[model samples]
Target: MTDIAPASPRHQKNMYMRQNKVLKDKVESLELEVLHYKEQIDKLTLGDVPQIVKNWMNEYSLPWEIFWCFEHEKWIAELDNLFPYHMENCRCDKCES
Candidate 1:
């Protein structure tokens, strides 16, 4: 094995810049992916089967009873997260209507 010399200051700065650019690019790509997912989630309406949930059910191929129980639990958790802290005081027109 050969010993390597440390990078010079200019070389180190160049390496750092390349790394920063790569990281920034990766973050931008991930942000776009999250936005895509959010758009897909937003398209869901009442009684609609979300693609992910449908895939999960098809992949597992669970009995209807088991699937519904798990589905209900998942909905409960989602509902808990979706509600505002002051549910009764929500100002949205949809909530009022």
Candidate 2:
């Protein structure tokens, strides 16, 4: 009768290595897709926002203008608390108008 031996640690290690390689390839493919999407987003919007935010805008058609307005208001309130006189005389477009 033939004795079937258990897989050695070396064999297990090789199996794990192959699995890791497959996972690495998948991760790299996903990363490339993310980069492609980022390039498309950069072409669409000529701004310096994060890629994730830009992608979210593109995917969901979110109202970024409204978000920016609220963000600016929050920033102004925080800045005003920190530097009241400076914020008051900032003379930026939002502040002026």
Candidate 3:
């Protein structure tokens, strides 16, 4: 069997540099995507969001927290849909449904 030669130091460095650049570019792209998503979330929270979400936003100071709740706890949005009329008029601490 033929002996295999290891890569030279310079070749290894260039490969590492190329990998680093690729990783940096990926990170930058991900950061931009995150920023875009954050902007969209901000727009939704500040602009034409659902009234239930708006009410929850008023109740809780943090908009993202409320949005997160709606995302993870789908029952909240479902409950809101179930009782839209009651939710509109009522302003109690706990919703019956």
Clashes of each: 0, 0, 0
Every candidate's lDDT = 0.50, 0.54, 0.58
> What does candidate 3's lDDT look like per residue over 1-97, in tens digits?
9998999999999999999999999999999999978866775557555676667667655443434333232223433443434444332233334
Number of the candidate with higher lDDT, 2 or 3: 3
Clashing pairs in 2: none
State TM-scores per candidate: 0.47, 0.42, 0.50
Error at 38, model 1, angstroms: 0.3
Instruction: Give the CA lDDT, 0 to 100, for residue 18 in model 3.
Output: 100
Instruction: Rank all candidate structures by their lDDT, best first, as comma-separated numbers.
Output: 3, 2, 1
Better of 1 and 2 by lDDT: 2
lDDT of 2 by residue, 1-97 (tens): 9999999999999999999999999999999999976765564367565554456457657544322333233212112333323433323237545
What's model 2's lDDT at 96? 43
Highest lDDT model number:
3
In candidate 1, what are the lDDT values of residues 1-97, reduced to their tens digit? 9989999999999999999999999999999999975654564333565464465457656422222223122221121232333223322223333
What is the alpha-carbon lDDT for the whole of candidate 3? Answer: 0.58
